[model samples]
Target chain A: MASNEEILAGLAEIVNEETGLATDAVELDKSFTEDLDIDSISMMTIVVNAEEKFGVRIPDEEVKNLKTVGDAVNFISNAQA
Target chain B: MARKVVITGLGATTPIGGDVPTMWKNALKGVSGAHTLEDEWVAKYDLPVHFAARCSTPALEVLSRVEAKRMDPSTQFGVIAAREAWADSGITEIDHDRLAVAFATGIGGVWTLLDAWDTLREKGPRRVLPMTVPMLMPNGVAAAVSLDLGARAGAHTPVSACASGTEAMHLGLELIRSGKADVVVCGGAEAAIHPMPLAAFSSMQALSRRNDDPEHASRPYDRDRDGFVMGEGAGALVLEAEEHAIARGARIYAELAGTSVTADAYHITAPDPEGLGATRALKAAMFDGRIQAEDVVHVNAHATSTPVGDKPEYTALRAALGAHVDNVAVSATKSQMGHLLGASGAVEAVLTVLAVYERQAPLTINLENQDPEIPLDVVTSARKLPAGDIVALSNSFGFGGHNAVIAVRNV
Candidate 1:
């Protein structure tokens, strides 16, 4: 299973790449909607890319709960475990 | 009285050029944009036709990766052209409420629609991108441009096949006449060079089948005329009320004196042989401009190089302009640029505005044996117009029997 640190790093990279944001702006505590300006469509893109990267399928119903970067990282780490 | 409208800026990402100046220069030199399509799908699908007029610069070259991925090719072209026009206008401060957009596309986002369907059939619904619906919509370009420019007055899309672009101009003129927007960014874009549309157009016998020589395939008014060559690109113009433009000290290109749109209930795809609807449209455009036919020295004809499509436009011109049609130096720009479908009228309108401003008409290419039936004076070489107040009409007709005409005059 991917560790929390590794999952956070992967999520940061995927969010930055998908939304054209800097890695520093994609902090674990920052909300994707408020801080990163990642809209719903681009969030989906991040999920799709992250799924391919981590080999984990994040279900659609779980998407709304992953509001902050930390939430995304924890969700990915637990899903992998 | 209607408020006077003037074109303040012009932009085009066409087969001949990526910008307006380059397109105008190449058009005068009689350069052909047609070439044998080099896509692998040409061989994969084994399409009957082998040539098309692609944009001189690909959309990917002008747009960022993420931006391009989010938009369909038609919206990409529209945004590219609209941004150029807005920048060219040199208006840094804009009243968001006073701005509007009217963009036209004949077959909007055909590539995206078909590609998504292919994905659904091959990989299931989960594989399809979330942006597919917005990207494939007909009003996508209008919405994209409006959002890009922060236009709040309204965003409109007119889908009248080939006449769509000219119809957009008509809408823009009316919008201003009714005081809905002080400034309007209007034009047309198309990106339908996919294998499906190519095969479908070929099946309808609407596309020219000159596989060996791509350049000469779009020979409008030539006795050996076949059918139109499919081309993809976009053209945009920034239109402002005459007073607003003068107050801003913006450079004026030409006056959009008048515009009209009409429909022919005659047929689904073919034009009326007598050109009654087209003639009425032309006459109404001239009447709207309050200009006599003799004042109209040039015409940018919608001669798409089709066997049946070419002559009706001539008959319409003769009926609308009477003997003045003989003196008019008609230039069929599609002879070089190929038929842009929905974008053709606006592109030709830009050329017509330039012609009226510069007093020079672009040359027509590949008219080796001029069809005698079309008695109008086709400008074989670049010709100079009389240096005075002059008006030029740009004509466009579409598949649903739509006719649109706009008159531009020297300011």
Candidate 2:
């Protein structure tokens, strides 16, 4: 199982890639839409990329709760468990 | 008197180079861009032809990931080239209502359509991406370019096979002459190097099969020539009315004197053996430019290296220029760059404009033993052109009996 730090790094990379944000700017506590200014399409890309990287199937309904980097990391960690 | 149109900016992303200056430099040095394909699909499908002239720099290198993901390869190439041309023109501001786009593609978004079909077959239609329709649309490039530049006058895409690019140029000229727009950004792009097109072209005996020597496969006018090598890229130019360019103090490349588009109405695939439509197009361009054959010094012929296809262009040249065809420095640029399909005309038009502006014509490479039947003065080296006022013509013909020719004069 991947550690919380590892999941955070992966989330950071996808967020930066999909949103075109600075890598250092994407933190665990940052809100995806409010802080990163990511749109729905970008959020979709981020979810897809994270799903691929972490070997997890993120259901569409669960996407609403994963609004921040911390929320995504927690979801993936719990899903792995 | 009619308004004059001049080429103020040029851009290209081709197999020879990523940008206009580099492509032009490689062209002057007689560089060939053909290479064998390394894609696994080649072996998986056992494709007959194993080579292509891909863009020297892939579109992914220049376009942002988000932007690149949304567009098909054809649209990506068009956007890249258009951005370069727009920046090169040095135009800071213009009325959005007076700007327009005229883009072309021989076969649009082949990769996108095929990929979608493959996904549909393997994973069901539910797996297909939502962006497939816009990505695969033939007019996607023109629409994307129009949106990129905020062009409000119009956005047009002409689909005339290989002649599409030149036809776009012809349309741009007409738009300016008709006072529809002050500046028209025009060009063509093609990204059809997928397995299906390769197989189709190979089945039709239209692609070269020199698998052993890919670099020398595209030998236009050579006796040993077999067929054209498929190439992919895009070329763009900013065409502004003479008054507009002069008023802005833009650096003009060459005056787009005249352009003509005609149809053979003879065959769907093969050109008219007598070159009737081609001759008419050439003659009409000269007449439209008010330039006599004697004043024309060079021609960028659309010689695609096929045995039958190469001869008719010569016939058309002789019929159009008479004895002066002997003096015109004919250039078969496909000898080095391969056939760019619809993009060929716009690229060759850029080269012709450069030749006229720089007073140096690029050579026709790989013409080892020139065909005796077609004995026009094909440029064999970077030959110096004559000084004083001169005119040049670039000819592009395509399947479906379409013919397009543009006349460029030194400014």
Candidate 3:
């Protein structure tokens, strides 16, 4: 099992694929576009990654509520729980 | 015969510049915004493409950190451009019910999506960001612009792939002409320069990879053309009914004369090789404008430079306009700005209106040798149009075989 930090690091690979930015735990608090320069289409890739990783598909209705990294992490955690 | 919709004000945040005036100035000067991207993933993942057209002017420069943190780059751009358009209209007092917004994007929230994925994969899902969805919605731009303008009429988004933005404009025209709203802030936005899309497009060979020379990679209509260069930004226009605009003393740029849209229903990413869908759209638009085909001498073409994509537009024009096609001078602005995907049409429409208003059609850049098969008078150099005001048409086609046309004439 991975530590929370390891889990976050695993998530970074997803962000890296979507954003083209290979970030670390230090950059997790960063806004997607500002600190990391990720664009809109990249977010869709993240949702897809979370869905596959957590085995829970977030629907379009709930997808609109996500705005930050924490939101995605919480959504996945809650689903996995 | 019916109510006419006209452009009152315009705004844009593009790769070359931010705001309407700056963007227009840079566009006329033929500035190239494409640059080689430096990212760790390029080395780690070994992504094929090495460059993209990032906004020379970022939205954050005009927005606060708090404001910037809330929206995706696409929505941030929409709000920035919309605010500029509203201020440019010189209408300080507006009735909320009479105002509306229509902003569309091909893809949205990519950054948020990917970042959230990273949070879940490594951080055990509990550490994922909270605002992922809000930042990534496809209608985020429409929501932002509508809120900024206090637009009560409605906020609509038409996501028809690359044609999304132009479709939004056409919808805005319909809204005003149908008496639903007196004014509409309309445009398109896109921010998809991330590695996944880059890799996806690269795999499809839909992007230019001449990494050595980013500036000349987006060569449309040239015999050596390979693929388009992805670009990011937004373009917006303020449109109003002639009566409302005149009563409010708004400066009318040009009349939204007519518009038409059609779908190929053929290929998901390719046009009807014969230009069937495009021909129908052009004919309908010309008929709607109530103008003879001869009157339209200029076209702000949607030439994305993909070898297969550039030729069909010319074929469609020749089939649709026949003899009039020879007299038409096509301006492929994508030649300079790469392709803004969904926002390309709206940006070109804004440029076309300026061309008509200024009586100077900016030439297609990077067109050293035109393809011999494309039999039309493409304006290779910026030239002043001859006397006499006339109707001009804007065409936008999307990946899903969706197509839209808009006609503008001097008021």
Best by DockQ: 1
User: TM for chain B in all models?
Assistant: 0.99, 0.99, 0.97
lDDT of 3 at B113: 82
Model 3 regions more than 4 Å off: A1-81
* TM-scores of the candidates in the order shown: 0.97, 0.91, 0.83
**lDDT digits (tens) for residues B1-411 of candidate 1:** 789999998889899988899999998999999999999999999999999999999998999877888889989999999998889888788789999999999999898999999998997776687889999999999999999999999999999999999999999998888899989999999999999999999999999999999999999999999999999999998999888899889999999999999998999999999999999999999999998999999999999999999999999999999988999999999988888988888788889989998999998999999899987799989699899899999999999999999999999
Provide the DockQ value for model 2: 0.23
lDDT of each: 0.91, 0.92, 0.82
True contacts kept of each: 0.46, 0.08, 0.00
**lDDT tens string, model 3, B1-411?**
678888988888888788778778876777777888887877787887888888887777898765777788888888887888888888888889999998989988788788788888986764565567778889888988887778999999999989998899889988998889999999998888888989998998899988889888888888888899999888889998899889988889998888888999898897899999999998988887787788887888888889899899999988888888898878888877879988888788888888888777766777778889886687776577656877778889998999899888977
Two-way TM-score contest, 1 vs 2, winner:
1
Highest-TM-score candidate: 1
**Sort order, TM-score high to low:** 1, 2, 3
Is 2 or 3 the stronger prediction by lDDT?
A: 2
How does residue B276 of candidate 2 score in lDDT?
A: 98
Residue-wise C-alpha lDDT for candidate 1, range A7-77, written one tens digit per residue: 88788888766666777777889998998888998888788788878988899999999989998998888
Instruction: Compose the digit string of candidate 2's lDDT tens values, residues B1-411.
Output: 999999998989999999999998988899889999999999999999999899999999999987898899999999999999999999999988999999999999899999999988996764566678888999999999999999988999999999999999999999999999999999999998899999999999999999999999999999999999999999999999999999989999999999999999999999999999999999999999999999899999999999889999999999999999999999999888889998999889889999999998987989999999999898988798999999999999999999999999999
Compute the interface RMSD for each candidate structure: 1.5, 3.1, 8.7
